[model samples]
Target: MGCRQSKQKSKDSLAGAKKTGSIGNGGAAEAEFSVISAASKTCEKLGVSSKQIFGLRQSWKGIKRNMEDTGVEMFLRLFKSNSELKNMFHEFKDLTSEDDLRANEALENHATLVMTTLDDAITHIDNYDYVSEVLRKTGASHVRFEGFKSDNFLNIRDPFLEAVKITLGDRYTDNMESIYKVAITFILQTMVEGMEDALKNKAT
Candidate 1:
């Protein structure tokens, strides 16, 4: 019964994806369909469609061009939203001013690491299982940090999305925004799962 329900949900989600594809016509429509059809064959995990995957990879190109700025902006926004999160990083704990945070090399390096990790996930978007495992390991590694929590992983969603939006600039269309949301949600959820499992194992 549960399996049947899950399958039904997948169908519903896929059907819903078609509604967003109603943006362009003529050559653009043909091009969009071609990309979506190819992606459909390649990615069908975690309710993520081919269209979303295509959009994700394409939008990431913009982010990749300005990785440092985008990453730093993400962290900056994240820190602003939750100042105490900075305490999780020994290097950032002492920095309180926004100017100082931006200038700090350690913060920039850490930001790069975070952005690069997302790039790694995008690189293996088609292999959901492998990406999940890699993210799990990443989460597990964070267990070493005294104040780290699974929720912290989830917290990255908004700031990350904001950074991507800023980086994409004019290319950040509504459809692309939806795709990024789905991609980031998948990533954060998988990371949280991995962290929770690790934390449980550590308690044993």
Candidate 2:
């Protein structure tokens, strides 16, 4: 009787497992379909084809560097207009005066973390839900981590976007609404290419 009960329980457990697996797969399929549908809608809105979006191969590292440089450039621009802000920046810079090497090391470490976080986020595009959740969480967490309010994420994005506009000049801003659409195209292309390469290597 004990053995029979154990066998029956095993069979039930297996059935439950199968059902859970099926549900998980269905959910993933739905998510994938939603992503594709959203991409299509975006392309239509931008008056561009999907092929245009997914055709370019871009370097993730280069994008992150471009973004960071843009931020630094914007900071400098803002500093020029605000003496108080310039003083604050100088004060921050002065803290490292005692040991130039140590200051350099600290700057390098911070840069590494920033780039790593951005790259990891980008590389996980195959899991869109996860990527979205992480971005939201990261944005919120940055406030506490950086000793700023949670709303700074939204505030900060505008400045960076503006910096991009300034840096790219008229070429990037010609089609105002489609700027983001074209940016997403490059991002998705890079992500898909990376994922494909990863899968091919794994299969080999």
Candidate 3:
């Protein structure tokens, strides 16, 4: 009887492990499908057509490239004329922290907050103040800095929104206009704040 019970317990443990693994894989698959669906919906709303959206990844690639280019240009304008900003930018670009493991974890946390808030911003179009607060907290957490000023935010906001508008086109109009704006704002804020932390760490 004891031997039989031991065998049964081992079997149950193995089954539980397999079930957990399956659940994890399914969760990951669902997340990927959700992202794909969101993209398809955006394209459809923009008049891209369902077939085109799925068939050509190039359009999405182009959008990302354009956004990056726009971001680079805006980054240059924000830091180019100012010596301090330029130095800070260089420091950030060349950062190699002593505590790399912690830094990596911090970055992951920062990314999660930013992405989550941006998604929330898209969903909650009416609550601009709440969305803004999320963005602010995300930025602060990323940089580990106090007192992130409004001007610092505005420097990146215009170009970021322009990039989104250009990329999304009619989709921005179809979904609540504020969603795209808040999403872009949250993204740029996160990027800038993360860079700020990297720069500060490098400087120290």
Best by lDDT: 1
Estimate the TM-score of every prediction: 0.77, 0.41, 0.33
Please provide, for model 2 over 1-204, each residue's C-alpha lDDT reduced to its tens digit, 9 standing for 90 to 100: 111122333454456656778436466445444445544453454455444333211233334556555545444444334324334333344442424423454444543454455456544333344554555545434332323333322323344345556655553434542544344443434344444444455479
Q: On TM-score, who's better, 1 or 3? A: 1
**lDDT tens per residue, model 1, 59-122:** 7888888999999999999988988898878887888898999999999999999989899887
Q: How many clashes (backbone atoms < 3 Å, residues ≥3 apart in a chain or on different chains) does model 2 have? A: 0
Q: How does residue 136 of candidate 2 score in lDDT? A: 51
lDDT of 2 at 19: 76
Best by TM-score: 1
* Alpha-carbon RMSD to native, per candidate: 11.1, 16.3, 15.4
Question: In order, what lDDT does every prediction score?
Answer: 0.76, 0.43, 0.44
Off by over 4 Å in 3: 1-61, 77-87, 90-138, 141-151, 163-179, 186-204
Compose the digit string of candidate 3's lDDT tens values, residues 1-204: 111122333454446656777436465445444444444444443444433323233223444444434344434444433324334332353434434422444433433443344445444322334444555555555454444443465465565455455655665453434444544555566556655655566589
What local lDDT score does residue 154 receive in model 1, on the 0 to 100 scale? 83
Q: Ten-residue segment with the worst summed lDDT in candidate 2?
A: 1-10
Model 2 alpha-carbon drift over 4 Å, by segment: 1-65, 77-128, 143-147, 176-178, 181-204
